[model samples]
Target chain A: MKKTSVFGPTTALAAMVANPLAAQDAVGIDDKVNQVFADLTGPFVSLIFAPFPGTSFPWIVMWLVIAATVFTLYFGFVQFRFFKHAVQLVKGDYSDPNDAGEVSHFQALATALSGTVGLGNIAGVAVAVGIGGPGATFWMILAGLLGMASKFTECTLGVKYRNEYEDGTVSGGPMYYISKGFNELGLPGGKILAVVFSIFCILGALGGGNMFQANQAHAQISGIVGDYPGWITGIIFAAVVFAVIVGGIKSIANVTEKVVPFMGILYVGAALVILIVNYDQIGWAFGQIFAGAFTGLGVAGGMVGALIQGFKRAAFSNEAGVGSAAIAHSAVRTKEPITEGFVSLLEPLIDTVVICTMTALVIVISQQMIINPETGSYMLNEAGTAIATVDGNSGVALTSAAFASGISWFPYVLAIAVVLFAFSTMISWSYYGLKAWTYLFGESKTSELVFKVIFCVFIVIGAAASLGPVIDFSDAAIFAMAVVNIFCLYFLMKLVKTELSSYAARLDSGEIKKFTH
Target chain B: MTVKLVVGLDGTETGDRALAFAKDLASKIDASELIAIYVIEWSPFTFQTADENAKRHLRREEEIELATSRIVEPAVSALRKAGFNARGIVRHGDVAETLDKLTVENEGSQIIVGRASADGFTKRMFGSSTQNLVMHASVPVTVVG
Candidate 1:
C-alpha cells in the first residue's frame, strides 16, 4: 500500500520511473527499425556521397595555401625581382655544364616541370572551379605568383645541399636539404625531420608522382581510344614507362629535355588559339576573373571564400612550395645553386600563370554560353548545382569540351597532349620515387629493381582500380612534405640569399660566361 | 682444350662496342667459342594470331642470324683469321637470367658485357649485363667501359 494519494510525491516519482522505462523500450524498438531502414538505403547514401569528397576543398590545400603565403612574405616578393633572371637561366644564358652535376639547367627545369605540369593542372583545377566557383581561379593566380618565392628557396637549398657522387651524379631534394639544412642551422631535430621528409617523399612519389600520373594517362588513353579497357591502357603506359625509366636519370633528362619544351609550346599554342578566337570574350573574361576574385559575384560566399578557392587550386596545380620540384632541380649541372633556383621559379609561371589561367578562361567563358537564364546556375546540374554540360562529362572532360567548343576536333589534340603530359610526368615522378627509395634502402641493384617493378605494377593498379582514399591520402602526404620543407627553407633562406648575391656579382663582372652548357 | 665466352648486347652503339670487345678477347685465347645473345621482352598483341607468332619467331631468329653474321660472325671470323678456333651461337631470355643460363650451359665460359652509361632506360634498368653477371654468375665477367 504505497499511498496512491491525489497528489503524493512518492506516487509521482513512481510514475516517472515507470514511464521512462516504458519509453526507453519503445525508443529502443524505434531505433532498431530505423537502423533496418537505413541498412536498406545504405548504398544509395554512399552513391550520392562518392563525388562529394572529390568536390570538397581538402585541408591539405589549405596547408599549401598558408605555406605559399608565408614564403611570399618572407622572401619580400622575390618572385618579381628574379622573374627576368629565371627566364635568362632557362635560356642557357648562364648555364655551365662543366659544373659538378649530371644534367643541364634546362634539363633540370624540364624534369621538374614534367612533375608539376600534369593532370593536377587539368583535373585538379577543374575540380576546384567546379566546386569553389569561378572566383577560385583568381586566387589560384595570386597563389601562383607567391609560389615562385617558395620554389626559389627550396630549389636553391636543394642545389646547395646536394650530394655529389664520385661519378659526378648529384642527389638532392627535401630529404637531404631539410636534414642537412637544419644541421647547418644547429637545429636539434635535423636528422629526424630529414628522415620524416624522406618517408613522406617516398610515399608522395609513389602515390602522387607515380600512380596519379599513371591513372590520368590511363583515363586519357581509354577516353580517346574507345573500346580499350583501363588495364590495357595502364599496361601499355607501364611498359612505355618501364622502357624510359629503366634508363635512369640521364635517359629521363634526355627525354624530358626534348618532350617538355615541345609539349609546353604545343599546349600554350593551343590555349593561345582558344584565347585568340575568343578575343571578343576576353574583356568580359578578364572582368569576371578580377571581379570574381575580389567580389565573388553569383557565388554563395564572398571575396575571402574566393581567395581560398583560388589559392588552393593554384597551390595544388604548381606545387611551388611542395618541395617535390626541388628534388628534380637538384640534379642540375651547375656550380651556382641559385641559377637552378631561378630556373625553378619558372615552373609556377608556366603551370599556373599560363596554363591554369587558360583553363579558367575556357571554363568561365563556356559557362556564359550554357547557363540557364531561369535557374541562376548553368544549364546542366551537378550535385544540385547548375553547371554547363560541356561534352556531357565533368572535370577534365569539361575542359576538353571547352576546348572543343572553340576548335572542333580539338579534344583529340587535347587528348594526345594530356596523355603525353601524363606520361612524361609519370616518368619523372618514378625517378623522384626511386631517389627517395634509394635513400631509404641502400642503392643496391636488387633495391633499385624492386622499386622499379613495384612502381610499374602500381601504374597498372592505379589505372584499373578505385583508389579514392589512396589518392586523397597521398595528396595529403605531398602537402605535409611542403610543410616540412618550407619550415626548413625559412631558416636556411640566408644560404639562398648568399648564393644569389654571389651569382649576381659574377654576372656583373665578366667572370661567368653565358651559355657555357 | 676449348674455352667458351658468352657476350650480351642490346642493339645499340654501346652493344656494338661490347661485341667488338668480346671478339677481341676471344681472339686472344685459343679455341674460345663466342655466343651472342639478345633477350626479347613480351609485347601485347591485338590477337595471338599464327602470323603474329610466326613474325615474332622469325624476327627473333633473324635478329640472332643477323647478330651472328654482322656482329658475332665478324668477331669469330677475325678470331679464326687470327689463328684461334671460334664459333657463334644465339639464345633468347631475360638478359640477366639468360646470361646465367648460358654461363652454366657453356660451362666455364667467361661472360663479357659493355659498360652501360646511365643514358637510356634499358641500360639504366639492367645496368651492364656484365655488371649483373659479375655479381651473380658462377663464372668471371669483364665489363668493358
Candidate 2:
C-alpha cells in the first residue's frame, strides 16, 4: 500500500494500482522520454550554464548581475525614485479616462506578476537556500531590487512601440520594440535582434515556461505517490492548459489577474502565519541569513558562492530582466507608457524580495540547515555547502519539508500550491510563447492554434519524464531570453529615460489629468 | 439627393446634447437623416474557462441586444420625437473604432459627439468617447461642448 496522490491525476492511478498495466506502460514511456530529453538538451544546457573558464561562476549569472548593476546606476535608481508613481499607476490613479489599450494598469501588472511569481518563489528559492546557504537570501533581495529598473525600462518600451490594430487590439514585446525602435533610431541590427528574440521566446516558452512547470509539478506529485509514472499527470496538466488557452490570451490575462492576487495572499498569508508562530526565532533566522550571506558557513565559494546562487535563483524567480513581463504589461490601456514601467517594478518586489525571502526564512528557521549552535554557523558538507534535508531532493521538496516541520500538514498544502502555481505559470507562458510564434509566423487562427497545440504537447512531454537535463536546459533557455532582451534594453534605455523624464515633468505641472474615485 | 449625418450617442444626458446639436446642424445643412450609434465599451480582457470562451460570442450577442433595447431604443425614439428622420444602432468593442466604422459603413458625411467631460470618476477612466471620435473617426467630427 503506497501513499495516495494528494494533488493531481497520478493519485487515482497510484491508488487503484491493482490494475498496474497502464501505470507499468507509463513507466517505460517515461524512461524513454527521459533518455531522449537528456540527449537532446544536454549539450544546450552545458553551453548555456557553462561557468567561465577556470572559474566557478556561470557567465549567464554574471551577465544578469552586471546588467542589473548597470541599469540600477544608469537609471539613477529609478526603481526607488519611481516606486511611489508605480503604486499610483497600479491603483489606476494616473490613467487617462479615454486612453485606449487592452487592459487596465492593475490587470496588466497582475498578469505579468502571475507569470514570474509562480514555481520559482516556491521551489527555486528552496534550491538557492539549499545550495548557497541562507545567505543566498541576501543577494536574492539585492538582485530583485536591481532587477526592478530592468523591468521598468523594458515595459515602458513594450507600450511605446506597441502595434495598435484597426480593431483597437495591440501586440507588443521585445520583438516590436527591437524592430520598431531601432528603425526609428536608424540602427541596422533591430530586425536581427527582433528575429533572434522571437526564436528564444518560443524555445523559452516551451522549455522554461511550459515544460519546466510541468516537470516540477510532476516531480512534486510523483514524490508523494510512491513512484508512479508522470505521463498521466502530464496529460491532465496539458488538458487544463489547453482548456484555458482555448479562450485566448485575454482569458489567460483575466484568470492570471485574479489568481495572482489570490495566490499571493494565500502563500504570503501562510508564510506570515509560520513566521508569527515562530515569532521567537524570526530574529534568529535573520541573523543566520545575514551571517551566512557574508560567511557562507564554510561553503566552498564562500561569500561569492552565496552571492552567485542568490542572484541566479532570484533572476529566475522574478524574471525582471527577462522581457516576458513586458508582453503582459504592454496591454495596459494608458496613454503614458511610463506608467506601466512604474507599475512593473512592483512585480519583482513581491516575487523575489518578499516571497523568496519568506521561503528562505522558513527553511532556515525550520532547523533544516543543521546549525552549529556554538558558532551560529550552518553545518556544511565536505564540499563546504549545507546539504538539503532530503538528499538529492532540492526545489519545492526542501521547502515543503521546512514548512511541514512547522505545521505537520503543510506538505499537502504545498503540493496543492505547487500545482496551482505550476498551472498559472503554464497558462501565462503559453500566451507568451504564442505571441512569439505569431510574431514569427504571422497572426492567424491556424498559426495561433498550431502554437497552442505545440505548447500543450510540451506540457505532456514535461510531465511524462524526469528529464533532468531537459529541465536544466529549459531553465537556461528562460535565462537565455534575458540575454537577448537585455541586449535590446541597452539600445532602448535612452528612449525609456526620455519618456520617464518628460512624464515626470508633466506630472509635476499637473498636465496629466487624474481621476480619483 | 439626401445627405446623411452620423451622431454618436451613449444614452447619457451629454450624449443627448450631441444628438440635439447634430439635429440642429442637419437642418442647417439640409441633411435628410441622422444615424445615431451608441457604442458600448467592451474590452477584450476576459477571465473565463475554455467553455466560456467558446460561449463568448453568444454572450456578446446578448450584450448587443441588451444595449440596443435599454440604451439605444429610447435615444432613437427621442430623435424621432424631435421630427428628425433617424435610425438607431448599437455596437460593442473599442469605442472609437466601432463608431468610426459605423460612420463609414452608413455613409454618414460627418460625426457629432459630445465633448468628453470628467463628470464622474467612472467617466474619467473610460475616457471621452467624443475625443476618441474626433481623433479616430473617418469623417469630420464635431465635439459639442
Which consecutive 10 residues in model 2 chain A have the weakest lDDT in total? A1-10
Best by lDDT: 2
Per-prediction TM-score? 0.66, 0.77
TM-scores, chain A, per candidate: 0.82, 0.90
Per-residue C-alpha lDDT of model 1 across residues A205-281, encoded as one tens digit per residue: 77777666666666566555543334666788777777666644345435554565576677677778888877898
Highest DockQ model number: 2
Among all windows of ten consecutive residues in candidate 1 chain A, which has the lowest summed lDDT?
Answer: A1-10
Q: Cα lDDT for residue A90, model 2? A: 71
lDDT per residue as tens, model 2, B17-78: 88889888978888888898877776544333222322343455676678788877877788
lDDT of 2 by residue, A114-221 (tens): 677777788778877888888899999999999888888889999899877654456788899999999988899898888888888988888878877786677677
Clashes of each: 6, 3
